[model samples]
Target: MLYLFGAIALFVIFDSVRGYLKTEDKRKYLVRLFLELTVVIGLLFLFGPLFVLSPLKIGYSTLKEGNITLYYPGGSIDMARDVMEQLKQAAEMNRQFYKANYPMPVVLAQSEFDMLRFGSYPYGGGTGSELSLNIRAGQMTTGKIAHEMSHRNLAMLTGKSMPAPNWFNEGLASYIGKMDEYKKPNELQVDLREGRYVRDILEMRGILGTPKWILKIRQGKGRVLYGQTYLMVKYLFDKYGQEKVYDFVVSLKTNDFEKAFWQSFGMSEEEFFQEFTSYIQNYRGEPS
Candidate 1:
């Protein structure tokens, strides 16, 4: 905010001096500058610190693909193109993995400020075929986009034919996004190694509705939730591969993820959850 004000002040002074020196009527362009400055400042405040409204007011270019469209600012053409390529690659990968071509997600990124408009947004998130994504203006990373696309592809792949219980949405996304790919030890493992871990999936597995519990938002507990679910999904995916787990998601359309669990992994939820916790307890860092 200080920088913004300082910039405005500098512009105002420069414009004032330019009008005085270059124009017969110094007050004329000075007045115009003041009006323009007012509008710009109003927009800046109205749009928050992110300048989201600047591009919105100015309008942005759109890039269209088979099933995706990227809305981006003119200055971000190169960055936007890069993201487009990545999305296309992701779509192709999803096609091979799902055995079906679904409506790919719409990718939109202009600035982090534009992304901040999303309520409670953390980097980016996707639902079905719509994606709200964020990038660092001229930069792109694989964290949030990968995770959200994990949710999107599965949702679209199943379409209306299969309605997953949605318990493992984030976990499933993290699994497909390959959070482990970065080779960063998860918070769960770090805490466990430090002997500070206390939450027990084994005890809570059957008592709490897995879907309800997983879906619930408890501030500051996202790591625990994501860690446990990611490990569980990783186990399932590694054991049965992507196709089998997708079949299990399809089976969940009947709202019987319990039955799907058995069919997919041949184990009850409680047993599986307990086994997963036990595995983490005995196994070394990171899941193989």
Candidate 2:
């Protein structure tokens, strides 16, 4: 009905215009009216879907191949389905890896980035929410999908109650996304030796407080930070053991990072940071 109402209104306007134009020749007046109406109809057809002028429900837009449902005002159904399926698979894998039972439904939006940017967001992908992937970024890589899925799984495992620190959240996501493999130690070492580190993970912990900073890093220098965070999480798991890692994740859910860290590793944040930093420096060794 909204569309019907709009069509009716258009017709009324056109008829009023036709009446006012009192052309002496009936044939000429009819021809002019027909041309005007045709132009209006053509414009409506071109832009109607874009604006969702009609409140008609595009019921159950299902992508069977992807095994996902896409709720959108308008788009290519086939492409949306494909993206949804890939994201579902990625989310499932993350859920298994983290052992999160209550997996939240993923929401997809068409934006410049495939994944949702962090900050004060409410409805879809925002603070205190589970996984929300941007459809645009979904087209880029399955890795991006995995990264956001990690966020969702983490949120669910913790009952969406406890808030995780920046390092832990981004690090866990980057780790699950398998970004570490993309950053070989040899390459990183070479960069370090040449004093050309692209992004310092420790530095980003401070800089990533703002949305603009986060967006910049995610698009530009942030890739390097992701690699570093992945490495840090991996190192933590390898050094402290997966059981400890599991406990830390649990503590994160319970909002007891201090207790969790101390209980599992017998160290506070300062101690752990000092040790971990030393360990990284030692492993890398002085250049020359």
Residue-pair clashes per candidate? 0, 2
TM-score of each candidate structure, all chains considered together: 0.60, 0.60
Which segments of candidate 2 are over 4 A away from where they belong? 1-69, 72-75, 113-128, 190-220, 284-288
> Residues 185-261, candidate 2, lDDT per residue (tens digit)?
55455545565453333333322343543665656655455555666677787787766787778776656666766
lDDT of each: 0.57, 0.54
Note the residue pairs that clash in candidate 1: none
Per-residue lDDT, model 2, residue 41, is 56
